[model samples]
Target: MEFYLKENGVRTQLEYGELDISGNEDYGYRPFQLMIASIAGCSASVFRKILTKKKIEIEDLHITAEAERDAEHANKITKISLHFIVKGENLDKGKLEKSLELAKKNCTMVQSVKGSIEVVETLELINLSN
Candidate 1:
């Protein structure tokens, strides 16, 4: 991917559209935000695949990511916490926990930053059948 330098940030043309990346949020997406998104997106996708393979029916899946950045060290991301809110009918917590473990093991983004960044995953299940 090639990026062109813009007045405030850099812009890259992707298949979907143009991507703008900058340190300033006013201009474009911040690097850290993209990183967190990548991690969370990867994890959620993998988890959903696992659930589907297990024949688990779900109504909705949502993920929230929180990151811890160190100000003294170039504001690098030190840790990331991912919270998954799963809404479904008669969902099994045990199966969801196991699926999450598989997701963390298989997710490319999570594995890529394994040694460097601490990743924490948590889950909340809402059963519509209740």
Candidate 2:
């Protein structure tokens, strides 16, 4: 589980695998993608963990992520939005909302972003077999 990164004008990677992330200027995920993936992945993990504890069975989970960048000398991410779609059986809105709230409270990834990150979550119960 190791990756080698080099800063050659643009970041580059030397190795990657299922257990590790490797990248290069042309083959690696952009720094921005890493940031976005962190938030999205962490939120989903937290949401699922909390909900599962409350007996909420998730059939599907999807997240839509968007970010706005500053248009100045140091153009960086200014705001990020995460739209969550949760599908399950007998999903409880209160529990679903609570899971999201708890995720927001405990997700280190979201906390690390250090800016205004808005999350919009929707819960839908679907029959996956159908």
Please name the candidate that would achieve the greatest lDDT relative to the true structure: 1
The window of 10 residues in a row where model 2 has the poorest summed lDDT is 16-25
Residue 57 displacement in candidate 1 (angstroms): 0.7
Report the lDDT of model 2 for residue 87. Answer: 68
Query: What is the per-residue lDDT of model 1 for residues 17-126, given as tens digits with 9 covering 90 to 100?
Result: 99999999999999999999999999999999999999999999999899999999999999999999999999999999999999999999999999999999999999
Model 2 lDDT tens row, 1-130: 3344445323333465232223443644567677788888998898888877877788888888887788793657776688787766666667777778888878898877556545444445453544
User: Which runs of model 2 end up more than 4 angstroms from their true locations?
Assistant: 1-25, 115-130
- TM-scores of the candidates are 0.98, 0.72
User: Which stretches of candidate 1 lie above 4 Å from their native place?
Assistant: none
Prediction RMSDs, each to the true structure: 0.6, 4.3
Q: Pick the candidate with the highest TM-score.
A: 1
lDDT of 1: 0.97
